[model samples]
Target: MTSPSTHHTTITSDPTVPLVRIVREFDAPAEKVFRAHTDPELVTRWLGPRGLEMRVEHYDCRTGGSYRYVQAENGEEYWFHGSFHEVRPSERIVQTFTFEGYPDAVALETLLLEDLGDGRTRLTTTSLVDSFEGRDAFVVSGMEVGVNEGYERLDELLAG
Candidate 1:
């Protein structure tokens, strides 16, 4: 008999900032999963809170490229922009994220995509922030919930 493998995930908070780590297994190949991230059209279809309206103002997803977008929730709009630090096709990507309202609070994000065989893929995202205050603010602001929801939407998009 073989035991089912389980994957572990962790989210930690420090005095200055917090780190969010997520690992999700998807029923798709790595290439397809990777495309969902780098392709603006695909990303726009699934990258925001489920009920919020999102508009991609600018999207240059290659290495050294940048992106900007706005999410409107209940008539309130939030602006976010980021620059791609690195892009490795079908494997990994690194980027810097900043909210327009909180210009000084920048976060570093690393995304890794791994193939789990049998046409399954495991995608892990790690986000590191600058200070504990910023981390607290993010958690209090429901960023975790939003991120998880976004991933769930991605899962559905990929399934389609």
Candidate 2:
């Protein structure tokens, strides 16, 4: 028998600022979770929603580095690029994220991995956009589905 989603992903927005935060707890260590994010091949294995094919053009996930990738679904391609501003292995990363569909709306994003001990981790990410409207648009974009499903895939990767 299978259980409902026990590993919940909390997606919240700041009422006073143009920021969106995603928090999730995983049954894996911080190092493992961090590797799943930084390693390009592992990323391609589970970066977005299921049923999509992802191809990485360049994924240099290091300080001052950048990356670009394409995710295709049903003959449609979605492009996203980002530049890493800071990278602290197993701890935190700060980057700039841009979706090619709306090039002008770039966001500053930060990823934090907290060690919960006993082989567990807490991942927290915050994305800060330029305006409340931009943030609202992102919130309304049905991003939770992609994020929740992607994390489920990550759980499988970490388990295996």
Candidate 3:
């Protein structure tokens, strides 16, 4: 959850499965929210934590497409790549995520956007990894910092 914002992201880990589930509500239309995730320019604006600079080397957000990007801070860079398995406009996305630091650990991620009416959208994401240890590592890796910050920035983008 965000520390000081009106909107919050609820991140939960499943005890029986190697999954991380995130739920959040945004005060924006589903189209806008979906665009922020699919558009390379909009994604670069708010995809990572506050300090790091994000660069999308290439982003083709469509079914059967793949993307790669890098985020850097203090001379250290983090690279991530993924393949889009399904892309339903303004509704759902299924993808595979891999961090270059742990090449063997890949997570299948699913994102769903539900229109809550009145220009609000509920976003839910689930990431399923290979093992419980991998899930635990992801939860302890300061991921909340990036997730919350990125959503906060997205809230700002939506409002602006």
Task: Determine which window of 10 residues in candidate 1 has minimal summed lDDT.
Answer: 1-10
**Clash pairs (backbone) in predicted model 2:** none
* Backbone atom clashes (below 3 Å) for every candidate: 4, 0, 0
Question: What would the TM-score be for candidate 1 when compared with the true structure?
Answer: 0.87
Q: lDDT value for candidate 3?
A: 0.95
Q: What TM-score fits each model?
A: 0.87, 0.97, 0.97
When summed lDDT is taken over every stretch of 10 residues in candidate 3, the lowest stretch is 1-10
**Judged by lDDT relative to the true structure, which candidate is superior, 1 or 3?**
3
- Put down candidate 1 lDDT per residue, 43-100, tens digits, no spaces: 8888866888888999998999999999898889999999999999999999999999
Model 1 regions lying over 4 Å from their true place: 1-17
The sequence of per-residue lDDT tens digits that candidate 2 reaches over residues 44-106 is 988989889999999999999999999999999999999999999999999999999999999
Q: What C-alpha lDDT do the candidate models reach, one value each?
A: 0.82, 0.93, 0.95
Error of 2 at 157 (Å): 0.5
Off by over 4 Å in 2: 1-5
Give model 2's TM-score versus the native structure: 0.97
**Residue 44 in model 1: shift from native, Å?**
1.2
